[model samples]
Target: MPRQRKRACQDTPEPETEAPAGKLVKANKAEIPAEPLGEAKTSDSPEKNRATKESGNETSRYWLMKSEPESRLEKGIDVKFGIEDLKAQPRQTACWDGVRNYQARNFLRTMKLGEKAFFYHSNCKEPGIAGLVKIVKEAYPDHTQFEKDSPHYDPSSKKDNPKWSMENLILS
Candidate 1:
């Protein structure tokens, strides 16, 4: 079997519970098909694993992104850009942004266009895999990190070469 990459994220913070309403949406998938249940076959055979590993031209990639239902500031408001929030969007589309951590920011840089990411809810009563979102847009500088009024703003981050990046993840 192939070895998985050791990411910087240690605590997933996902609690087992009900799923989110964000699943009932759609997105473009000309190459890969959507699975509403978020279930897929995991090959254990050496031959099958070797075959997948040999497919160097494969463009699709999978990911799991964790988000909190309510942020520290929005705790009492019962509002944070969770799965529900993404579903509430005009077209059920949103971007995974405002990542202040350096390590997480680096992970975002690795995201490629059309990559599939599982939207997992964290810091909530029912924290678990909620739905799926596709990386419609690739990594780019996060504009919020430049705004002085925004909590994600970084004074040290230069405009030419920003310290953070973000990607558009729409419901799939």
Candidate 2:
């Protein structure tokens, strides 16, 4: 069974703190609802509209993926990935990789194809949910783990038995 995160109470107010730029943190559990929550986007592209409509499935699970919008140095690698960066990718799809947290990686593994997730912009001056994305592919071995130059490299993770996994997501 997959591990579940602790849910925060809706009645309780959370204290706001000043977080440094490019830091990643778990989102508030209280804000996650059974149904999708966000402003409806109108688009000229039919493909974009289709993805948006297809995401409204009853079985589709929701997740919050915190990505740093501002650039910062981590293990000598510049970490400045954001929602706009995802949109600029080929077919607007990219691998959700470099997750080091054990529990967070497990959560990524549990994400099913077609499921929806909030592209949360964390550790910035105006941090918030930037956009939504749909899981285009299921969990697979994270290629970055095998790259010696990659910041997420894990020397112990052999090709035969990889230690890290990642999912492919498309802009929704």
Candidate 3:
């Protein structure tokens, strides 16, 4: 008996007659409608729009911050104890930086001049609220991002148009 070779039609499965591209395919769930790219759809309801506007205008009435006592002690030693010692430390005057969360970013955006925040020390043996900080200036471009040697440098950020920033805060 001679060996036989299969024809292309015999080897391959026949292609099904199906709907063309862009046509809806039958599925278990209904297809989700996609919004146009780069543009957010606004609510048609007037009440929803009014509520959104009001919420955007609302100031962050309060906030809390944290620092470590051991880190503070490592930085410097002081004869005075308690809140006074913490207040006297140089780190107390340091700016709050490196916050990357979108919600935190939004809060930072909402922060206005003179807004007060409670400084709290965490991840330490004695974790608790430490002191008060006043927002001395509104949000501005963070200089750290521009430094090539800095850990915070972002290549995406430019000197003219910065994405990340810091706010001037003073101890009170």
Quick one: best lDDT, which candidate?
2
RMSD to native, candidate 3? 28.6
lDDT of 2 by residue, 22-141 (tens): 223344534443234433445567544433444463344578787888877766667678876766555556678888888788888888776778888877877777777777778888
Would you estimate the TM-scores of all the predictions? 0.67, 0.66, 0.50
Model 1: CA > 4 A from native: 1-45, 50-56, 74-79
Instruction: Report the lDDT tens digits of candidate 3 across residue range 1-172.
Output: 2221111111111222321222111222222222111222256775434222245653334465433444332113221123433344343344545454556655666676656665555555555555666665666666666756554557778899877756655556
Model 1 root mean square deviation, Cα atoms: 13.2
lDDT of 1 by residue, 34-92 (tens): 23223233468654442222355443557767677665552122225677677766455
User: Which candidate number would show the highest TM-score if scored against the true structure?
Assistant: 1
Worst 10 residues of 2 by lDDT: 4-13
Off by over 4 Å in 3: 1-60, 68-93
